[model samples]
Target: MAKKPEPQLPLGSSSTLRGLTESFSFHSSPESFITSRILAFHKEHPDIVDTRAVVRAKVLNRNVAIVSSHAQIQQVLANDAAGYEAGGAYDELMAPFFPSPNLLLTDGGKHEAMRRTWEERMGSLKENVIPLVHQQTTEHFSEPSTSEIDLYDSMKTLSWKILLGTFLGLEHRDKLFETTEGLQENLLRGQFSLFPVTVNTGFWHSPRKKGKEAKRKLQAQTLAHFKEKESACPFATTDDGALEDIANHSVLFTSSLAVKALASILTALVLNLYLYSKEDGRSLAESLASESDPGRRSQRLRSILLETERLSPPIVGVMRRSTRENIIPSTGEQADVKIPKGWDCWLYFVGGGRDPAAFGSTWDAFDPERYINASIPQGAAFGSGPKACLGRELIREIALAMAETCIGLGIRMQGNIAARGVRGWLGWEPNDAVKPADWAQDMKQLPTQRPSEPVMVRVARS
Candidate 1:
C-alpha cells in the first residue's frame, strides 16, 4: 500500500515580510504581531498546514528565518549541520544580568560539565526539591489571603522564594533572603535598558551599571553564605572551583530569567484553570481534590497543565545564531533554504505548538483529553535537544505542587481578570482583527510572555 506524502512548506518569498521599523515593532509586541500578522499569513496560505509553514523575514535588523512547523523545528533544533548556535545572542542579551557564563550560555563540553555538576549539587529532586516545594506551597496557602491579589506578582514572589530556598539554603525569612531579593530585582530591571550597553562611569546613572553592581554584591553574598554554611547548603561542594560555579549558577536560578519563567507559567496555568472552571460550571480544583485514585488525579493534572502550556507558553520563542552558512533540509518536498552565517534563527514555540498538522484542526481550543494518551508532541515550551532547559523537572515539580496546593485550598477568583494590553482569557491570544492601538499595551513578549499590567483577582475559600 502507498503511504500519503507530507505537505510541503512554501519556499517562496513571504507576503507578510516585515521591514526594519516593522521588525522593531514586532519585537516590542511579538504576541500581538504574531496574532495579527503571522497567523493571518497562515490563513491566507492554507496549503502549508492546511497551514503549518516557515516564514523568513528581517528581525531587529538581522536576517532572520522563523520556523513554525513542529517536525521542521525539531529537526533544526536537533541538527548540528543546521549551524544554529544558542550562545551568541544569549550571552549578548544576558551579559548585564549574569556576570559569568551560566548554563544557558555554554555549549559542548563546558555545557555538559556544568550541567552534570549542577545536577549532582541539586541531589535527588524527589527527595530534596519536592519536599521543599511542598513545604513552601503548603505554608503559602495555609492561611489563604482573603483579599484581592495580583496573580503575577504573587507567583513571582513565591517562585523567587522557592528557588532561593532550593539552591542557596536560604529560608524565606532568612536575613540574606531579604537582602538579596532587592538586589536581584534591581539586576533584572537593568536588563530592560533601551540600549543594551553598560556604562561604568560613577558620574552616570545607568541601569546596567546598577545591575552589574547588584550582580557583584549578590554573588559575593552568595559565596560568603555558602562558605559560612557549607555543611548546610544543598549546593555546597569542596571540589576546586565549585564555589565559583555555584555562585555563577546562582544568577541563573535567582534572577528574573528563571524566576519569571516559572511565575509566568504558574500565572497562565491558574488563569486557564479558572477560566475552564467558569465555562464548565464546576471547580476543577474540587474535581481533582475529590478524586480518590492518586494515579487518575496525577494524570488529569498533567493533562491540564500540558493543555495550558500549549495554549500559552511562557517562553514564546528562542533565538539561535547560525555558526556558518548552511542549508536547512525540509521535512516535506520543499527545497532546503540556505541560511547565511551569523544570521539569527528564531524558533517560534507558540506557533509550533499551535501547528494544526501536529495538534489537529482544533489547535486553538484547550482540550486536556488530547494529552491523556501521551500520543501528541508536548511542543517546545521547555525547548528540545541538547539546548533544552535544565530546570525542566524542577519546574514541573514546582508547578504541580503549587497547582495542587492552590486548588486544594479552595482558592477561587473574585472578579473579572484581564491583562492591560492583551485580550482573550489566556492574555496572549492571537487576534488579527484587533486595532494596532490596543496591541501590546502593557506586556513583555520576549524571554517570557507575561502581562506588565496587574492581573488582579480576589481570592477566597469557596
Candidate 2:
C-alpha cells in the first residue's frame, strides 16, 4: 500500500474565503486558536510552503504573515537578531497581563539583561524548585488514596503551589492564592476572549478591575517577601530598575503560564501512562521502578517528557512582529518575502512538530524513541531563538518529578476519559492507521483546542 500524497491549496476557493474572514479581524476567538484546527489546515494544504513559506493576509488592519514552514519560521525568529521586534497584535492581547517592557515585550539589550537576571536567580534556586515539585505531587495524591481523581484539576493545584511557593517565594497561600487565582482566571479568560478589547470596557470591566486589585495585592506581598529575603535570596531583586519594573509580570507568568504549562504536561503524561499501562500490562511507574540503571531511567523519563511536548505542546503558537520593512530570504519552498513594518507573524509549533517531511511518515505517532537518537527541530517545543522560554529547565524538572511520583503511585485511568469540546483539549489516542478524512473530521469537531471535561485517574499501590 502507498501513502496518500500531500494535499495542495487550490486557488480562488473556500480557504481563501477563510483567509479573508479570519484576516480581517485582529482578535482570535478562543476557537480560532485551537491547535488541532490550525494543524489540520496546514496538513491539508501543504502548498502553503510552495506558494510562499509565509501565509500572507490582513489582520488587525495590518498585513499579517503566518509562517508555518519550520525552516521559514526559524528564519523569522532569527530575523529578530537583525531588526525584528517582538511585540505584535498578540502582544496587545497579552498586554493586559504582562504589560510593556516585560521579558516577552523587550528586545535587544533590555531583553538580554532581564533574561540574564532570571537565569542567575533560577540557577541559584534549582535545589529548591525540584524538591518542591515532588512535594506538591505527593500532597495532591495523598488525600484520595485509591479513589478516582481528576488529574487535570490535581495538576493545576499542584502546579500553582510549586509556581507560587518555589518560583515566586510566596508562603501565605490562604490570602494570596485567592487574589492570584482571581487574576489567573481573568488573564485566561482575557487570553481567549472573543472581543479581547472589551476586557477593560463596560461589563467586562470587572475582570480587568479585579485583575488590577489582585496585582496590587500581589505587589505588596511580593515586595514584603523580597524585603524579608532580599539578603538571603539575591534573586528577589526589586530596587534595581531591571526586575523591579516588571514585578507584576513575574506574578502573571508564574501564576498563569507556568501553571497552564505544568497542568497541560501532566495531563499528557497521565494519558500516555494510562494507555501504556493498558497495552504493556504494567504502568509507567512499574517499568520505571524496575529499572536499575539510574542513567537509563533518567533518559527514558526525559524522553517521555520530550515526546509529550512534541505531541501536545502547552503553547499553541508563538507570535512575532516585524519592526521594520525587510525581506525574509527564501527557503526551498518559496522566494524571498518582504514583511512590512508592524506586520504580525505567527509560528505554528504544533504543525511544524508533526510535519511528515521533518519527522518522517509516522510523525504523528507517540514514539519516545524518535528523540533518543534523533534531534527535534529548533523551537519544536518551548520555542527557539532569542525569545525561547527561560523556564525550560524548571518546567522539565517539575515534569520529571510529577511523572516519577504519579507513576510510582500506580496512576491509571479510573473511568472513560472525561473530556469536553468537539475533540477536547486532551489529544485522542494515537492510531497510526487513521485516515485523512477521519483526522479532518476530528479537527473540525473541536470547538476549542483545550479540554472541556475533567481528566480522571485512579491510583493503586503496585
Candidate 3:
C-alpha cells in the first residue's frame, strides 16, 4: 500500500473567516479545539507548519500564531531575545494565584538564581524522595477496597502528600492539607472561569472574589507553616528576604498546578501501561518486576515513561508573546513566518510529538521501544530551552517510582474508564454511558490536561 501525499497550504497566509470561527470555537469549546479543530487541521494540511489567526473577543482582539513543527518550536523556544518573551499568558491567567515573581514568571538572572537554588535542593533530596514515593504508593494501595476506586483522585492525594513533605517539610498527618486543598480548589475555579476577566464586586457571589480570598488565606497559612518549619525546609536560606522569596514561590508548587499535573501524568501512565500490555499479550508489569539487571530495568522504565509523556503531555502547549517584529527562521521544509510584535505564539507539544517526520510513521502508536536507543528531540515533552520546566527531572523520578510500585502491587483497571477528551489511545474503551455532549461539558485544559471523569481501578497484591 502506498501513502497518500499530504495537502499543503500556502505559507504565511491568514484566514479572517476561519480565524474568527476558530476564535469562537476556542472561547466556547476550548476542550475540543485541540483534539477536534487543531489536530484535524494538521491532519488535513500536514505541510502547514505555521498559520496566523486573529483571536477576537469582547475584551481583546489579538493576532495569534500556532506553531506545530518540531524544528520551528525548538527555534522559537531557544531564542528568547529574538523578540519573544515568556510569561505573558501565564501572568494573565495565574496572577490571582502567584501574585509575586516566581520561577514561572522570572527570566534571565533572577530565574537562574531561583532555578539553581531549587535544583540544588531537589538534587540533595532525590535520594530520600524515591523511598518516600515508594512508601506512599505502597501505603495507598495497602488497604482493601470493596468497591472500585477513582485512580485520578488517589494519585492526586498521593502527589499532594509527597510535594508537601518534600518542599514544605510537612508530615502526612499535618492539618493544613484540608485547608490548603479547599483554597487551591477555590483559586483554580477563579483562574479558569469562563470569562477571562472576573469582576470583584460585593453585589454578587463571584468565584474570582472567592479565589482571591482563598489566595490570601493560603498565603498566610503557607507563610506561618514555613515560619514554624523554616529550619527543616530543604531549600531554606539564612537570609530572611531570600527565605521569604522561597516561601512565596512555594505556593505555586503546592497549589493545584504542580499537584494536578503530576497526578494527571501518573494516571495517564498507568492507563497507557495497562492498554499496551493487553495489546502485546504480555504483562508489562511482570517484565519490569522480573528484570533483575538494575540498569536495564531503569532504562526500560525511563523509555516507557517518555513514550507515555510524548503521547499524553500534561501541559499540551506553552504560550509566548513577541516583543518586537520577528521572523521564525525556516527549518528544512518549514518556511519563515513573520510574527508581528504583540502576536501570541502557541508552541503545540502534542502536534510536535506526533510529527511523523520526527518520530517515524508510527508516531501515534504506543511503542516504548522507539525510545529505547533514540535521542528525544527538544520540545518533545517537558519542552526546550531556558524556559523549560525545571521540575521535569524530579517529576520523572517520582512518577517512575510510583509506577513501579503500582505494577509491583498488581493494579489494574476495574470498570469502564470515563474521559473528558481522547488521549491518543488507539483501541482503549471508554464509558459507553457518557454521551458526546457530556464529554464537552467535562473537559478541562488549563492548569493540567487530564480526564475530569473518574478512572476506576482495582489493586490486588501479587
Candidate topping lDDT: 1
Worst 10 residues of 1 by lDDT: 6-15
Superposition TM-score, candidate 2 onto the true structure: 0.79
lDDT of each: 0.71, 0.59, 0.67
Best first by TM-score, ranked = 1, 3, 2
Which residue runs does candidate 2 get wrong by more than 4 Å?
A: 1-53, 57-62, 79-81, 89-91, 145-147, 171-173, 196-206, 228-246, 277-279, 326-333, 374-379, 410-449
Model 3: C-alpha RMSD to truth? Answer: 5.2
Q: Per-residue CA lDDT of candidate 2, range 83-102, in tens?
A: 57675555655665554567
TM per candidate comes to 0.86, 0.79, 0.84
The root-mean-square deviation over C-alpha atoms between each candidate and the true structure, in angstroms, is 4.1, 5.7, 5.2
Model 1 scores a C-alpha lDDT of 0.71
Top candidate (TM-score): 1
TM-score of 3: 0.84
Q: How do the residues 1-462 of candidate 1 rate in per-residue lDDT, one tens digit apiece?
A: 444444333333333444656577667876566555555765775554324445666655566777766766776677652367778756656765785777877776787787787777665654677778878877766666767788889888888878888878788888888888888877877776655577767688688778878888888888787777885456536774877777777766778767888888898787766645535576566677778998999899888888777767788878788887766665454445566677777788877787777887667666756689788888678778777877777788788878877777677765454443444425234433334445477677666778767888776665
After superposing candidate 3 on the true structure, give the runs of residues whose Cα lies further than 4 Å from its correct spot: 1-24, 27-60, 80-82, 196-198, 278-280, 330-334, 410-443
Model 3: lDDT to the true structure? 0.67
